[model samples]
Target: MAADPAIRAIAALDDELRRGMYEFIRDARRPVTRDEAAAAVGISRKLAAFHLDKLVAAGVLHATFQRATGLRRVGRAPKVYEPTGGDIRVSLPPRQYDLLAGILLDAVLAAGADEGARDAAVRTARERGHEIGADHRRRTRPGRLGAERALTIATGLLESHGFAPARDSPRCVRLRNCPFHPLAERAPDTVCAINHAFLDGLLDGLDARSVTARLAPQAGECCVRLTATT
Candidate 1:
């Protein structure tokens, strides 16, 4: 199997010269040319170009050819490099702490009260889950979802969120992975509550009337489980 693209991209920065050049281009107010990057890292222009191209291939930098002042020049314009606009992350088993932190911070800012932050976070999580459920329902057009249909939709949605849901029975699904992970371990009550409410909202929005979100905490499993009501 091939190496993960993200891991390869991150590993490319391990070289001393390449790391220096990357930082120079990233902090530059404008895109940098091969000459400027070479001087910044004390390397030859040819060597700088070689490393820069490697970075580009790794998706760490973007390359473009343009005149220094964005005007037409008599000679061929210099190739400029800049940091890629998006972030690159690599994690085995895939924990998304950045996403969780953003949600919490957004809730805190929106609520503007310390006491209400948790409540806000729960509401935000539920609303997001509801929107996802509603969107999935619209796209799939599975009208009046029965227990099996609801399980299928639920499993897909959970899997997309990194829950690793598996069907335990026709009426119950077991989630093997927790996207929140250690945070859930550190703050079980709050995190578990938010997860429950989120799943509840998802079921509601999905119109999976035969299913209900229930807290059935088990070792090495998600805090909430979806079960058939009848």
Candidate 2:
């Protein structure tokens, strides 16, 4: 398996001097020169350059060239280092929560209608879910998808997509993981609506008769639940 880049990034601060330099650059909140970093950490300029470049290679920091703002010797612009300002996560077994966030964020940003961002997110999520279901019907199985078989298909597909769906009964599917996560907790009214709409669209696209998607909010679980209709 490929190595986690986050591990290497964290390891970049293993040394005391390197850790100090990283903390100084991060707290500086501006492009910091190598000399500034060295003075702050009480290290030699040459040593600071070495540690800063190491941090760059490990993706903990980024370097750029900019001229000093005040009067100084006229020469090539000095290189400066800054924090990349990106999150570094190392979840066990990996996760794609960011991907889900990106999709919803895009939907929200693209929403220009007076109806609002929540409405747009729900609409976009349903459309996306429908596309997934329809593609599966087209590429995998062409027969009419009855509720039971449709649920089976959906569970497998959603699991692969990080929903962590569980078969609570022969008829109901409970999603244990909401990739939307803290965002869902922060705005259940909006995010739950999107989840419900998405699953509803998934069933509709599957042509799975007699199945219903509903809001079944529970702590430590997804807001949407699916069941075979009576």
Candidate 3:
């Protein structure tokens, strides 16, 4: 599938220090010194300092200097750096698409095991899907929530299940991609069951109901469309 342009842009950052600094901040939690990052990545302190400065300029990291309290020292202390309160930095881990692809292919094989196997597999998938959706709904439910709140609740549910949700203007919640689309193409009913249970759990959690999802008929196509019904 062609990547979403936005996602592609994000992936493009992998070739630069932005990516490294992002990982540094994400892993370190606290701010780190240039020498620390340099040693960690086997780069020179000057190079690390240069890239760290760029990150600070990008508003992704913050800089602070602390002077030592030593009575004999006359020079200013070095700057200590840390991440700013902002976007959670992003970095791609080693691609594990093989594991995900294997699980999906296994779903297809499991469905083909017997005449009733498809339905059985779908039931299990639905239950698991619903369990995930229910958990996320509980976590993200707004205070004083109502049916109007189901939109956010349902989007969060789908996102938690590895579906990338996007808004098509205001009227539609377009599922940009599905991790299971390949398996779904072979087993539409199974996919539908999963979507139904997911939405059902999300809406139920928000004290809301009335959602519809339809699977598109091809691999890599959007398989879920969720929206408030009312």
The TM-scores, one per candidate, come to 0.78, 0.58, 0.45
lDDT of 2: 0.83
Assess candidate 1 and give its TM-score to the true structure.
0.78
In angstroms, the error of model 3 at 216 is 6.7
Q: Write the per-residue lDDT of candidate 2 for residues 68-174, one digit (tens) a residue.
A: 77858687899999998888877643355665576588787788767677777788878877887888888887597677888899898788666789999999999
Report every candidate's CA lDDT.
0.86, 0.83, 0.58
What candidate 2 gets wrong by more than 4 Å, as runs, is 1-95, 105-112
**Residue 98 of candidate 3: its Cα lDDT?**
39
As a whole number from 0 to 100, the lDDT of residue 223 in candidate 3 is 62
Q: Is candidate 1 or candidate 2 better by TM-score?
A: 1
| Residues 109-194, model 3: lDDT tens digits | 66644536445545445544455556655676555544445566667756544567776645457776655555556766765565
Give the candidate number with the greatest lDDT: 1
Candidate 1 — which residues are off by over 4 angstroms?
1-5, 70-72, 109-117, 138-149, 169-171, 228-230
Residue-level lDDT tens digits of model 1 in 83-162: 98778887666666765676687677777555576799888777767887998889888989899889899998887677
